[model samples]
Target: MISIPFSGSKRNRYKEVKQIIQDNGYKKVYEAFGGSAVLSVNLFREGLVERAVINDYDRLFDLYPAYLDIKDTLIQKCLEAGFIKSNKRLNATQRAYLQSMIATIDEKYWRLLANNFVFSGKQTGSLKPLYFTYFHNDITTDKQREYLQTVQQMERVSMDYKAFLKQYFKDFDDTTMIILDPPYMNSTQKAYDNRYFFGLSATLQMLQMVKEMQVDFIFFNMIERDVIEVLKVFGFQDFEVSTRRITQTSTSSREDCLAYVRNHF
Candidate 1:
């Protein structure tokens, strides 16, 4: 079993979010975007969140993480993906054949489609990118081993936020803190890397619902044209805190864009 270090993600903002929740005397926390679940895992680890609800639309968000109670399936999915990848770098015909063979398959075969899509070069098809790419990293045996170990660990102690909420949040209101890390509208232009496609208007509608929840809230978003306009509509007059976008791949044209918030002001 290879060791997988706990590399932080955009959810690293959980540290600050945790402090805000605690300082505000919140008892229940909600992590709505739950990709990688870095926010849920870290806050739960720190014991800052008493009860939480972590939800995401992505299947991989649930399929891969231990928090979703999917531990034993990791190794199986990896194996089903088949370790003997097309090392020769499949030609167009071979790639097409593989895609044809794997498309519209079952959840058990998510690994196969994922492996061929990525290692064989993802072909265009009706199945959403997120559907096939869930197993994209399954191409390497060593990487699979590492993934299995991590999923095992995440399963062993991962927070089941949904279960926690159903049993606890029925009557909770103001004491609840909702933390949103939804995909930023500014990130809409990116398509090459693994990014879940979400309708911008739909996301805005959800944010509107979040505002109506009357629960204390915080949000993480990339500062961009669409976002500023959305925030304005939501009655956010001042930004609580802001940080510059980092990393070399974070949109060259939007390097000036940042991660900002509305609740801080």
Candidate 2:
């Protein structure tokens, strides 16, 4: 899979999460917030699912299937944007160029650059500080080429999860499952602008709808009061909670209940 740098990517937990899906014997999979397409691509690559569908509100996801069509141009442009090189620190002119390039590059390339290079990999709409000197060496032409092979003509939808399910949930059968990683429960309003952000009420509503449909689901989130209450109301009793945090050069544990709920309603 192409290693796109993404903030809050579930890359670290993919294996653990995939095991839950495997144990549940879901033949068809849908990732509701397909961030980085990490889980979706891995499932497809490993032949773990008969069909995998990915959807997200992020605009960049719309261009994923087209990565092959523009891979070479994007690589050259990334080189020009200084992502293919090392610079532990940026000089004034280099910073100025990046600040200006933000407006000059095509939207797709800009999205790629910002998401991959910016500090924390945030969608800041401007050139934020660089994350570090060098991107992972794996982000090379060969990698993109291989990733294109996996994503080309793959099933994907760019829309809100609610609307997406409204249109497509009936297509799923008992063998199908939804894997969800919506924004954190206490996310700031700005962080989850309700436009692209799935809020708590929306999440609760989706859970209700999924229970009604009786499709199995695997959900990832932080354990907050409302989440626990919702789980109680839905009659879901299986969940795992742990503390996980990662930094640039270190991994640390914190005191919090990071929840994983597998609801076989």
Candidate 3:
């Protein structure tokens, strides 16, 4: 199995996931809930799958292509515009500059860096300093340019993912396979804020709709009793658990990892 390490895996459970999809005769697959799109990318890269169907409710996905295409151009502009230094400790003027940047610079710079930034990754827009500080020119200009160029394909790949899902899933049938990874409740997301919270119920409803039409799918779900009961009612019998993350990672004093889909998947 092609293992992409972007998200957590419990005891090689993802291996089982890869195997199930491969054995099902599904060359064209769907990622119904693509958090990072890592798995689809892995499958495409490893030649285990021929095409993909990736969808997420988040609108930020629309910006992925633009971000990839312009990533280096934006960084170069920042450097040319006087961005410099490492761990020099943001001084008053520099801090003010960063604050000002949060207001006018590209949103991509901010959204990607909010994790380790000052605002703890929840703030809206590019108002945090963490968004702008990663613009250091640590490598030769040529290398940085090449690296960003490589990422530029994300735009093309995203576009391809969108088109493939639209064209193929319009008539989803027994031949089609769905990989479900519905969002679970967590710190960065909540029931009302992110679609995954109360969204699970709605997503399950969607799954029911698809299943009724004879769509072959397996859910990698949060082992909520209600959700489990709902799946059981729909005749879903197979499951496996993976402990990706249970609660908010930043707030937990110590990791309180919860078992999800471990034995159930």
Candidate 4:
């Protein structure tokens, strides 16, 4: 299995989600908010789905293809920079080298490296002074190869989730399962880049749109009163699941709920 050092990644929930899809006999999956694209990759790897699509609003959407284009170079650069071989905290000089690399390298490589090195896998454009954390050595050569192989099998795109849904709705069928893991209504947005924040109105609008489409879907979110009420209005029932909540300051396990319309099954 390929692990993505990304905040809000569904690594922990992949097994349960895969089981749900398998039990429902879904042959296709559309990851509406593909943070790391890990779920889709895992499903494809495990042969649970015949087709997978990964879409995201951020430029991180482009990183997968970029990685594929320069997998060797990126791996070599990380190894040369002492990022892939060690799991220790970076010293001042080592940190300076990383910052310099981020400042001077191509935007794609820098963004990929920045995410890997940042604290708790929170997305950042550049490391904040005094906020740089220990280097994550999880993306080794073998892992990179695994990621490349799985991602190559997926259809990836960068677009607004609303636009993505509207365009793909006609293509959905009984065998298709839509995975909606939108940004939480109650999160500080620190886990995400500032520009990708999904506010309440947008969340409600998305829910209303999905309701109208009447597609088979699984929606993940933090438990919030207004969001839950809106989901109830749309006929979505709550399924309580434990998920680790990652924040800028700390990480804790919490009960997160996913809403699904019972009639869809």
Per residue, candidate 2 scores C-alpha lDDT tens digits across 178-248 of: 87777765555324423555567767777887777767676666545556777788887876655454443
Per TM-score, what order, best first?
4, 2, 3, 1
Candidate number with the higher lDDT (1 or 2): 2
Pairs in steric clash, model 3: 65-155, 239-264, 239-265, 240-261, 240-264, 240-265, 241-261, 241-262
Model 1 off-target regions past 4 Å? 1-8, 59-62, 65-170, 189-197, 224-226, 248-265
* Candidate with maximal lDDT: 4
lDDT of all the models against the reference?
A: 0.48, 0.61, 0.47, 0.67
For model 3, the stretches where C-alpha displacement exceeds 4 angstroms are 1-16, 56-62, 68-91, 106-109, 113-120, 123-175, 185-197, 224-227, 244-247, 250-265
Worst 10 residues of 1 by lDDT: 1-10
Residue pairs with backbone overlap in model 2: none
Tens-digit lDDT track of model 3 for 1-265: 3322223342235555567667666676676556555555455556666666465434444554554445445445545767664544445555566556555656554564332223333444425544444333232234323333332333222332234345555766544666655544322333422323545555566556655545566555444454566656766665433334444345643122222221112
Q: Locate the minimum summed-lDDT window of 10 residues in model 3.
A: 256-265
**lDDT for 260 (candidate 3):** 22
Q: Taking the tens digit of each residue's C-alpha lDDT, what string does model 4 give over 1-265?
A: 6665553446777777877887888898888887777788888888889999888667564565555445446446656866644556677877776565555556546455544566654445554534444566454446655676677667888788888888898888888888888878766662334555577767788888887776777778776455467777767764433444434344554445565443353
Give the Å shift of residue 140 in candidate 3.
11
After TM-score superposition, the amount by which residue 77's alpha carbon in candidate 4 deviates from its true location, in angstroms, is 7.1
- For each of the candidates, give the backbone clash count: 2, 0, 8, 0
TM-scores of all predicted structures: 0.54, 0.75, 0.60, 0.78
Give Cα distance to truth, residue 199, candidate 1, Å.
Answer: 3.7
